[model samples]
Target chain A: MKFGPMKPQRRNRLLLVLFVVLAAASAVGLALSALNENMNLFYSPGQITAGEAPTGVVIRAGGMVVAGSVLRATESLRVDFVISDLQGADVNVSFTGILPDLFREGQGVIARGILGRDGNFVAEEVLAKHDETYMPPELVDVLPDSHNDPETFKGGTRQ
Target chain B: MRFFSLPDYQLIMLNWFHRLGAPRSFYEISGRLLPVLWVLSGLSILTGVIWSLGFVPEDYQQGNSVRIMYIHVPAAIVAQSGYAMMAVAGAVFLIWRIKIADVALQCAAPIGASITFLALVTGAIWGKPTWGTWWVWDARLTSTLVLLFLYLGIIALRSAMENRESAGRATAMLALVGVVNLPIIKYSVDWWFTLHQPSSFSLGEKPAMPAEMWIPLLVMVLGYYLFFFTLWATRMRVEILNREFRTDWVQRLVVGS
Candidate 1:
């Protein structure tokens, strides 16, 4: 089709469509901007340590659960574990609830609770986050155990 | 029918496209094509289900629960594409006043909404086991829910209007406005720190899955698209007959059938 356009009616309809599109775009843009913070499911441990997350209010903090950092109470459902982004300072998380089945050492986990003044997160609930890559157990066993260390593991698949 | 000389291939394709747009032609052609689609889609879905559920090995992290991906992903993929197709039809009807395109837009909304609902329910089922919750207010999840609502809104808007011409234009405009949400739904996980993971498969990159796993997924996705086409065509034909019943050609078709 030729690019020349001189029809008045077609041009008017085209302009009308463009106006509608621009109006819808700006409306959604403003709404998203207003809800930007709440849109993030959880704040990363790095963000928490950087003093970005507010204390005393219920918020979500998430990162890889540190290996061998889980401390379980023998008499109660209480458990304490340290979470980290592996590139920043660790954040201790304490919860008195049952953890998700997928929660494990070196796995991505998000906890909702209040951060105390002592720099500890008191969690009300914990949820696990799995990565995109999927392979059989046999394949996983064959691959080198490079993911064991939190630093080199590319933990959490952020971004 | 050609007004000017054209390349043989281009002329043939143009003829076919225009013929396919006619309500009577579409009804006749789709009647011949439906059985083929049914068989192909049914066979592929059967194979995909057996392969994904029983043959593929379990994931190291999720184990057997990973099979839910076979259903959830395809439903999500097709649901989005269906909305896009419906919106394009709506746009065509609005811009060109094509009655057939309006029929297509009207027929597609309910099927697309059902598929979107399927995706949401399957995602919730999958999420409860892996993410420890039935739902989340994250960007990805919320945007998909918005997609469902958009489909519902389009369907509701169509029914509420008494004038067919005005209803078609209104729904078309609404669909065009809601087109903005498609990109947001696609990039939500990337834009926000959601519990939902980024897509494992993309057209531009190799899938983040083994060949054995993704092949069946490919079959399932294909089957879903084919199933949608079959259903959509059938619905469009029924609607065309309903609207054109008073016409001489439709009367003849009814008598012949």
Candidate 2:
């Protein structure tokens, strides 16, 4: 439908609206693409075990480090640990670096890397994901019902 | 083309802008808005802060420290958008030669810079426990740092210029150029492997946080926006009075007050 009488002011308003629409459209388009490409989706051990995680893709997997699952190499910085979603599923993760001081067994952690063919999480980086206080969010639900108390939920020591 | 012509509505809108550009009208109109804005800003911020800090459950992971999010996230958000708002005002002053727009640009700079500073300080404080390091050259952190510098640069450029008109024009250009950094600061965590986490809030996607965690955050964010507008209007009024001291209306306003 043709627009009615093109008064000068009406035409200016239309032009301004058109310009703004075009700018907004392009900005939204750019932002969507950036978000799509850049979003490093986080997955849980359940998703990883179920083969829902994209293979060979760099993604974040977060969960509590399985109690007493840590194994440190004698001669190297390489360490192996198991992460569990606290819902019957788990992922074995291996990393070669100085673990963050906060990293420990039974605490929440997020490992960024690829899931290996042999069902291991080959982590490029392992971050201890606790807040200022001791409790890690990911581990809170995973802990046994009896260990729900914040005061009682302490870090698991390596045996 | 007929589309290029200025229509009647457009002229009316322009006329409104022109009228509002005058210091006297702005002073009067903004004066009416001041008390309402003050009450809204004060009530919202006070409620949001108290609710988030006391009533909200401690984050399962971050614990009490997650309380920082109530302040940090809101400050960071407002700080970034405040710069964009300043830049728009700068553009208006440059294109339309609106003295009020220039005053807005001048008044917004320090406030924006101060908020940006707050964001940085809070982020660093939050970083210590979460990241295990007080500082990292991560993409999000670095881009935010760059944003602070841009705000500082605009403030510095404005003060350095001896001529008021030149200062306005130069700072306007700088602000326009600095627009490139806004998106960068926003997308940095998503674009690269960064210790800093990705945005919790995004349009058309479910918030990464649970409603319980995010609801108070929304309240704080709203509070911060209101607070910024309140401060912005208050500062603009002071600036209008200062700039229009020679005008009769301002003389009357000063004497009456």
Candidate 3:
């Protein structure tokens, strides 16, 4: 009887609550999409193995910066490097923005912004993906054996 | 296309309002006046649509998107000023125990929320072409968004209570406390390092816009105020009747109907 059209309409508090929630969610989605004019693709090296990256997707490629591949300009602050997930394939990244002082070769980095038409990753922003002594919430699912104790911190050496 | 300097508008409107808040007089008057006010509201809205959509010249920089200014800026100003009026009414109600002021505060909350919503939506639409983003954590936008939440909170608080008097007093306290945030919300952009552009629609200084643009905007402002007056009056009439059902005036009206 409740399902029929002729049925007496109840207060339907659940419907009202859902309406409010959906309205708020849509508004927030619109607001955020407007905030960042550009979008970034997030992936590890394995995802790119099947095919080459599309021509114009702004992406965050997570990888280890190969040691000695970091060629810092002596006069200028520009740093040139190659990033690979230790999975054989690598991409060159160029950044002119302020690089964090701790940034060095063989550390994990997430470089965001567009992949240049010329096959280079044109990084608009770069953040150091430093490993912590204590476990982090973000690392929970990603780590297979991340011990909670400091001394039990296992090898995280980059290839 | 043309501007009219009608100095008599506000003065004439004030006389109409003098009888409006008087419960018995307005309850008797609305039957005769409702049609005229409704028609006037429709006409004013239609004229705004025609002028803002087709008549006004496009901004050199903003082009067609600037037309949204007619709705967004007017709504934002209404939203802010309406909340301020409600807070003042809340104070009057609390201090003087005026039922009419309480009714006014009760009626203002939802309308303020709607106006705030209209402002945010139009601002976002306009932002797409102008700021290259729809949402920015710029102080003005952030504060205005907070204002929308405050209006919502007041409405919810009022409705949550079963007793009318308790609801009114409770909401009045909240509105008064919220009043301090108004100045902060208004000047937040000036005080903070924000991505939002500084206020262009100022109340004090002469506006930077050409007379043609500002004149129509001024007309729209008048029209919005008139619309608000008309609604407030009608809603107050209904409230007075419902609250004072046992009174002779309400009894007479009920018999007349």
Candidate 4:
């Protein structure tokens, strides 16, 4: 059997269908772009420190927990740690609850609460964020400095 | 008539395509294809599971929990690709009014939904130990949840409509609309600040993990694709036979078998 050309009527319908699909896709794309900032899970320390994030209202700030910045209270569940963007901006987060299992020095964390007038972030809850890369203990031990390098794990900050 | 004539091979390809659109032809082709697919998928999945759980080393940070990636990542990957395939089938059905295309779309929804659910559940399980939270409404996680809902929504939409013809067209339109979410799910991590990290593997770039880690993952991913195709084709064949049971070919095949 010989292959035949599409009828003009059918060809018009195909073009109309393609046009509808493209138009719908672009509409959704525009809507998503408009809602982009609201879709972010948390604010980076850089944003918060720059006053880009609103103060006194409940908000979430996230970054790597600065190494050696954690201070635990002896009698209470209260803990204070500085989360940093690792590019100079830092925010102090004070929480009075149990931290998540992955919460540790140099680990990425998101704290939810209020930013105080004193520039301290009073966190009601804290959640850790893990990077995508994975390696064995032996491999990690071989390159201990790599883990400590902020450049290796820039996924911690939003910006 | 004004368009240039097709070559012999092109004509042959077009003939084969048109024939495959018929349920009887598809049934015969799939009957010969199913056994090979099932055996290969089974072997690949078995090897992949054993290799991932026992042979691969634990992550330095996440330890044993990192093993969840073998299932979680593959499920997510297959689930997204499944939706894309379903949408393509929907488009074909819409454009050509092909019965087999609609049948394929109908059969794929539930399986795709189940796989998407697996991805979400396994993700939450893995997140608890490694991310310190069971769930977070981050861009990546939220987009994936939307994907699961889209699958369920499609299935529900199909069942809700009484007319087969209108249901097929409606579901096709819905599937096409939701196709926009696939790219959102993929780029959410990179596009926005989310608790979920960016993908470890990307086309045209070196994988973030070492060869030892990614090799088994690659195997598991391919195995999952094979497994999905095996299940999809099996479901398609069963549905085709059920829809065509009154036809002579189907009755004769049933009696002969």
| TM-score of every candidate's chain A | 0.82, 0.60, 0.53, 0.85
Q: List-wise, what DockQ does each model earn?
A: 0.54, 0.11, 0.02, 0.57
The true-versus-predicted C-alpha distance at residue A147 of model 2, in Å, is 20
Report every candidate's CA lDDT.
0.86, 0.75, 0.64, 0.86
What part of the reference interface contacts, as a 0 to 1 fraction, does candidate 3 reproduce?
0.00
lDDT of 4 by residue, B1-257 (tens): 52247777876787788788989898788889989988888888888899999999988888899999999999999999999999999888887778999998999999999999999999999999887778988888988999999899999999999999999999988888889899989988877888887788888987877899999888888888998988898899999989899998889888995
Clashing pairs in model 2, backbone N/Cα/C closer than 3 A: A8-B6, A8-B7, A9-B6, A9-B7, A9-B8, A10-B7, A10-B8, A131-B62, A137-B61
Ranking of candidates on DockQ, top first: 4, 1, 2, 3
Q: Candidate 1 — which residues are off by over 4 angstroms?
A: A1-8, A144-159
- Candidate 4 chain B worst ten-residue window by lDDT: B1-10
Candidate number with the higher lDDT (1 or 3): 1
User: Residue A48's C-alpha lDDT in candidate 2?
Assistant: 77
Candidate 2 lDDT, tens digit per residue, B182-207? 88688765454455655666789866
Interface CA root-mean-square deviation for model 4: 2.8
> Candidate 3 chain A: minimum summed lDDT over ten consecutive residues — where?
A150-159
Place model 3 in a CAPRI quality band: incorrect
Docking class of 2: incorrect
Using DockQ as the measure, the top candidate is 4
TM-score of each: 0.93, 0.68, 0.57, 0.93
Q: Any idea what lDDT model 1 has?
A: 0.86
